[model samples]
Target chain A: MVVAEFVSELRARFGIEFKDLSILDEAFTHSSYANEHRELGISDNERLEFLGDAVLELTVSDYLYRKFPNLPEGELTRMRAAIVQTKSFSSFSREAHFDKYIKLGNGEEAAGARQRNTLLEDLFEAFCGALYLDQGRAAVIKFCQQVIFPHIDAGEFRGISDFKTALQENLQQDGNADIHYEEVSITGPGNARQFNIDVYVDDKLLGSGSGKSKKRAEQAAAKAALVGLGVIS
Target chain B: MVVAEFVSELRARFGIEFKDLSILDEAFTHSSYANEHRELGISDNERLEFLGDAVLELTVSDYLYRKFPNLPEGELTRMRAAIVQTKSFSSFSREAHFDKYIKLGNGEEAAGARQRNTLLEDLFEAFCGALYLDQGRAAVIKFCQQVIFPHIDAGEFRGISDFKTALQENLQQDGNADIHYEEVSITGPGNARQFNIDVYVDDKLLGSGSGKSKKRAEQAAAKAALVGLGVIS
Candidate 1:
């Protein structure tokens, strides 16, 4: 799609007209595209991504602080983390159809980089950064309120596993045990491998879980163990 | 000092009157104090510290982004880290005389927690949180611009030690060399112990340094080694 059409579409979708469209354009431009089109003098969005990460963090933090006035610091941190994680941002990007606007090099596009969660997450953050620069903090906050806060209000972040930490803390009160997680098995093909992980508390298997990755499987297993121990519901 | 006197002193010092003095009061109240004075209905500063941390990060990130437009994300992150580290915040707190106003329990006060850098840093962040809540983001930014920006302008954050990482990066080009730091000697009393550390590259003593702690001494030694190798000046 042409730059003008893309910008028009963005304005329509977001319901906010950007003062500096070039900044917004740069936000969607991948490094690969910039590298490929050296004569266009297009800059990548990495810097904007860094700025936007902070902006998003602060916006979410402010919301969380006000929304949960009585919540403790550690729980607040966990909630913020859940909302800001790559998976959550990727989901947001997918929902917003950010992939349709992202500009990439031929090679990257052929490699399906547009569909990649990490890239999508970075693009979303960069878009936020551009929005912040083009508008202001209030605009950024409003954007987050529209796109991000609904998820928080729905308690979408509640299921995020900090079960490992919770389990460790609970066990610590009854004297420290060597609580560890181990990948027990791997199955399926190389590209679609499923990992089975077990949570061990003092050489006893408390629970087991499976996921596409070891970390996820471990977290699932931890959650299971926490549930079994009646530490969490 | 009385709460009203303290509030008046804060107003005099900051030149900004808070609409809600209780929020500011909570910022200065340590958990220890609140735990001991349960009848006073005082809240601790931990939640404020958490909120203030995000505010400070966003403020610094925004400043860095605008100030050094050409800087890469990695460099921006490093610069932000330099400015926002606990040590830097503690310095800011000390310069602002935050230690004088902070409330502590008898036990914590007796143990000299008032002079602790970590506590001071937390207090400074809590103060920022209070200011943010009492005023707004603009007030927090203004406070940071007045107090924190001066340090950035003065290049106080430039010498923050990342020598170990730099040394490792430099060594990585010539294949991996076993680089390690070993504490050679400890001297002085418990409260003021000095550590002597030597940085070794492939079991060869490249440089040595002394400091108040092992980590500091190691960093100093790593810096010396980097200078010796002409990797950094």
Candidate 2:
């Protein structure tokens, strides 16, 4: 009944009713809540998030592939990441006022966890999963294209910029110093490792960065070095 | 000039003109070719692939967000992964005969490189990169929605299930086993790492897999185990 009310509110907001109420509820429910308080028989949104992640990626991939016929996969993937990051999803949750509608455990509520990026992102993921299951791909695609793509497209005219490269060039011109990158450490195993890189000038550590790969870490480190040097905006 | 001709050929095939011919060339140029001969003064597709990966993700993310009005992020990411993974990309490239079109070093060319999954996937990514730079977002979105998503949706509706969970479920059912995942070790200093995981049936290793993450390695192990058990078709 509570779930139905929530769905009704969402439907009223969007002017569309869902065929499956369970999907809507699942989208709003967090795993932590379900884990801590299982007696309510309320399920977590992890599975939905899992499913939603895939659905979201496919939709984004397809849109980019067709929309920017000249764009390659790597650029397309990055653009997708920027739009689908935890922060982005959290913002979407806020825009939709989804956090206000989420069903949280007392602990989560007391902890003021409803506004958390992690939670909001999870909720968004859960929602996608539900959409995929309840309304199918076509419906899901329709919803995403109508609501989300515009925001991303609005930023499509961004100028080509590389913070790290600019930073390096500035440092080189300032003192004729050779920029050096050294790997400090790596976290995670195999393909998931987060590389830590330190940028040094004349044997002095200027900045550090962490990323899923050495090059990215180096770029991040360079980017930080640039910021430290006040070389980039 | 050569790049322009290549773009024309691609345009003929995909029915889209290159907004930036250089982007198309980058998509077609393999890293091996660059590594083998620097005299060409040509950069490889690796960087383009890197950029395309991001672009692809963002494009898909944006599409999913609006298309699935009530959908979340997790499912969207997963679907994107399914579409972008080497297997899927390779399949798409193969179907499109992208391998025959890619410009490879003689060494790679002689090694049956045209049939290589990595090459095909890279080319696909490069193509996306090119698309984003050339025709902008609208064209890419149209093509992707028409081609990729439809196929996945069609396959999905036809009961094309995921391999990861199926393997996990089968493993869990044997003697009520509790599967544990661990990221044993990571290699390299940064974003690059090879993950190793051991899937135990009962504290005894039933399967072992290696990939970029415990999840991927576990999935790979699960798939291998399934193959060994004749569970995956």
Per-model TM-score on C-alpha atoms:
0.69, 0.46
What is the TM-score (0 to 1) of candidate 1? 0.69
Best by lDDT: 1
Give me the candidate number with maximum DockQ. Answer: 1
Which tens-of-lDDT digit does each residue in B46-85 have in candidate 1? Answer: 8899899999999999988886554557667889998888
Off by over 4 Å in 2: A1-5, A70-74, A156-233, B1-117, B123-233
Give the per-residue lDDT digits (tens) of candidate 1, residues A82-177.
889889999899887788889998878998999999999999999899889989989988878778889988768855445666677678898878
**Clash counts for the predictions, in order:** 0, 118
* RMSD of each candidate relative to the true structure: 18.2, 15.1
Proportion of native contacts found in each model?
Answer: 0.70, 0.04
Can you give the DockQ of every candidate in the order shown?
A: 0.25, 0.05
Q: How far out, in Å, is residue B232 in model 1?
A: 8.0
CA lDDT of every candidate: 0.81, 0.65
